[model samples]
Target: MSGAVPLNDPRFQTDPVELYRELRRDHGAVAPILLDGDIPAWLVIGYRELHQVTGDPALYSRDSVLWNQWDNVPDDWPLLPMIGRGETSIIHTTNGQHRERAAMISDALEAVDPFTLRQHAERLADELIDSFCADGRTDIIGRYTMLLPVRVLARLLGFTDEQGPGLVTALNEMLDGGEDALTGHGHLVEAATALLTEKADGPGADVVSRMLANRGDFTVEEITKDLLMIMVAGHQPTADWIGNTLRLMLTDDRFAASLSGGRHSVGEAMTEVLWEDTPTQNVPGRWATRDTNLGNRRIRAGDLLILGVAAANFDPQIRTDSSVLTGGNTAFFSFGHGEHRCPFPAQEIAEVIARTGIEVLLDRLPDIDLAVPGEALAQRPSPWLRGLTSLPVIFSPAPALSPARRP
Candidate 1:
């Protein structure tokens, strides 16, 4: 632990893949690290190591209450929002209770009509494009990618369209792990509470209503917390997936054919992004339930283990040919792995939203190209999630599609 790295090091925000390589070389799979405020923890960067950690729920638990550093953590710590404790949400639950909660969530999400989901995605994408189509130039991140997922998700979750913007603001601020994180969390809780109250009297054909109808015997507070979990888990990562995939399609020559009309490669580009530039870079994390060994590091009971998702994807042991395209290879840890991995239904929903949004953008603006050099593009400054701050692009001006013409 002599050269323990700080997780908040600026290098992690910019060019993290290289930093991951350095960490892997210097510390092997499990490296001693410091979270914000110099609190010690371990980062599991090896692909095999990460798989083992996530697969064994009994050994490496999701229950943050088991963390040994809580006593030293200040009440005002900015990271408290990201590393929450004593929450009754599905993310913190274990054993039989966790299974019940997970079943409720999966059932609700699985019931989403696939055709309607695509329709919502396409219509929302078209509406966003209509806002900027006449200008011939726009920052796709701020104007489109960042807004579309939350808007589409809001509609599916029974929130009014007017509520979408505020939700986006709060979700981003909370996920950014900054000074306003706690405040952002407060806004989300307030919004969820109000929405659940409204849904109680009158259920609808939405995820929230469906969860309410589930026979889980969940209380208002429990459902509200789970709703917040779903919103936070569903929004930003999907947005980043669209952004990263679009960036890949624009910058990489392999996908250049799609920019001109060959849309067949869109799925391939998206899959590649999962292996290369996943949205959820580093997840926080599994706590060691007892003394154990991982990747040559001795982990003590209650030790924090941060999942190095992006790092594991780049692990040389598994990725023997780093230069080779990851065509159809879905083994990457982006959506996570094992028992607590993202639900299959939720994964399907994210894919529909992202893939539909990308396809709609390409169909609407076939000639779009990056306005700035690809190297000039910068990433958002957060170690936990990886995405662009903005993706400026230009295309020939076109008239907006009339409402009659919209599908």
Candidate 2:
């Protein structure tokens, strides 16, 4: 549990939730660490502590990156940066700026409404599953889970299917740190350029096109970057949630039975999966801007901070019982917390994935099971992310067992 593991190791490549559980049990909430000769920081793993840190912007700041502000200003900082001395986007902005941007974004999302999107989500879900139902088996991560959100996000942003593959690839590359030139907001800059140059008007009702049509409120630059932010933030978490939920069901049919039982069970199952295996395992890294108390620790300026959403979701202290993570309990850290919480678009997307997508998948596929035993499935290696790189499931078209005994 202590030694460094290769990123591509089978253990790391499969069962990310188990790895997170192992790490939390071994490391605790405020674990000490030294990484690559850099300043050591505490990785907060408990649910209560992670919630506290994320909610309080006064002590911990999300803008941890040290921009080069020598004689010349860093290219990253904006002319009228919203927070602190240098300008940054809402995600990295702290306190007031973060709240203001969140309000704007939330208002936009609310205006879209869940009732309207459900029909579209259902249609998309139908198309995606129809292609694979005949195969009798598939990798949920690659074919099913990853594909739909990108499409939904593209549709929401006004991008065409023609542009979906490239945009998704670019976003993943950015997340994996493959291209140094696109670090931080530079990634957003690159994505926006691609959309503007190629898909700006080709043909689609993506979020980008919507923003362009509603140009009165946002600047071209702001529209471009915010769309990029949605692309980057929206797809992965939803994709991972869908994929991980399938993984959970394949491993335990009881959970699947419960989900398939009715509408209420579907919502309960989604919450349970989030608590058991949250899609976003690691919170964005925060830095202490000034000396402050987090729980009992004395955190000082420049000290790196990590809120372990995965760990916190499973915290026995808050959960009161571990099984609650996989089956019960209502409150959770699935979408994150407070100022740095995930955009509320997350709730609708999650509900869609849970009730519509997952329920239908389970109903259509019978006797489905993991290709590898649950223990053998691989996990993504990063401590900051929780997801399966691949989930191979065997599927068959058959009616579920009697409803009375199911679940």
Candidate 3:
């Protein structure tokens, strides 16, 4: 309710982090911003506010009911049905049906033993390292880090390597809000259609097929969308975290040296990376279902509520000091909090990404260093996510390690 921030303002587009910092300082925890050409919404930054919103389903609804409030907005806007649909999966769905569906999915994901995941994660690490070892110079984002999780998820979902490219491309396009902002759903729909109709064959086990056989409570359509969501959400954030963590390690040499010293050190290093650079920078959105009090202010029924997970993660009150978060800590809001928290599978996946990912990179390319100055790197400009379009790094000791022999 203070100085209004137009989403088009250069600050909104360029430096969202700094913008959030200022908003937190000046506008209190909850501030409103108009994004997508004046679609009114509130941005919530204070940890207390986000916790309150995420914890209460009755007061603050994630259901698509919020979309109906935006009657002036076009029918085709991407977020419309999403809000109306409400928590479709465990992430945001609030309705009992969606919760049941999520429970089923959770049961399925939980069925996969932790030891099995560890073994698979080890194999995945080996394969990714193999690809990058030959040249010792590869784009970790595109070539290795990103590919591994997709491979694992595909195998889990019963997808193929051949399907990887299209699925990955579709996911990127769908998420980037590119090529189909109006519909914001073509890529996922296409992939889901193909996947849903495909025959189950081949020597590998498929998560989708498993779900098909024992889809506790999800409809075929819901199952497919949930699978797609899992695939997209599972990998990209982990890849970004891996990349960001690597950059952090290279940025602070002493930290890297300490991390490389031993196995336990790797855990510490992962914690540091998480704290320093959370993979997903955007907080999920929520809407006020009725008039409510948030941090001493009156929130109307129709007002948009923004959860600034990034800002909350950096809040001085929760953290010991802002300076320490610079290295990567698990305490960050890159994931989320409360009842609307991310799925258990996603958390396990992140653990795999952090642990196995860091081990592989260090074991294989121990001498890898940032090729450019940290300040010179270009970060992507989306308030919903934080990542580099491309990160250029150079491996020292020349020829680097061979693929077969890489750690």
Q: Which residue runs of candidate 1 sit more than 4 Å off their true CA positions?
A: none
Model 1 lDDT, full chain set: 0.91
73-165 per-residue lDDT for model 3 (tens digits): 665654432333443544556767656766666666766666777666667677766655666466666776666676667766666667776
- Candidate 2 per-residue lDDT, tens place, 132-172, comes to 76777778777777777777666665566666676666655
| Local accuracy by lDDT, each model | 0.91, 0.61, 0.64
- List TM-score per model, in order: 0.98, 0.78, 0.86
Task: Quote model 1's TM-score.
Answer: 0.98
**Candidate order by decreasing lDDT:** 1, 3, 2
Winning model by TM-score:
1
Error of 3 at 79 (Å): 5.9
Candidate 1 clash pair list: none
- Candidate 1, residue 268: CA error in Å? 0.3
**What is candidate 3's TM-score against the reference?**
0.86
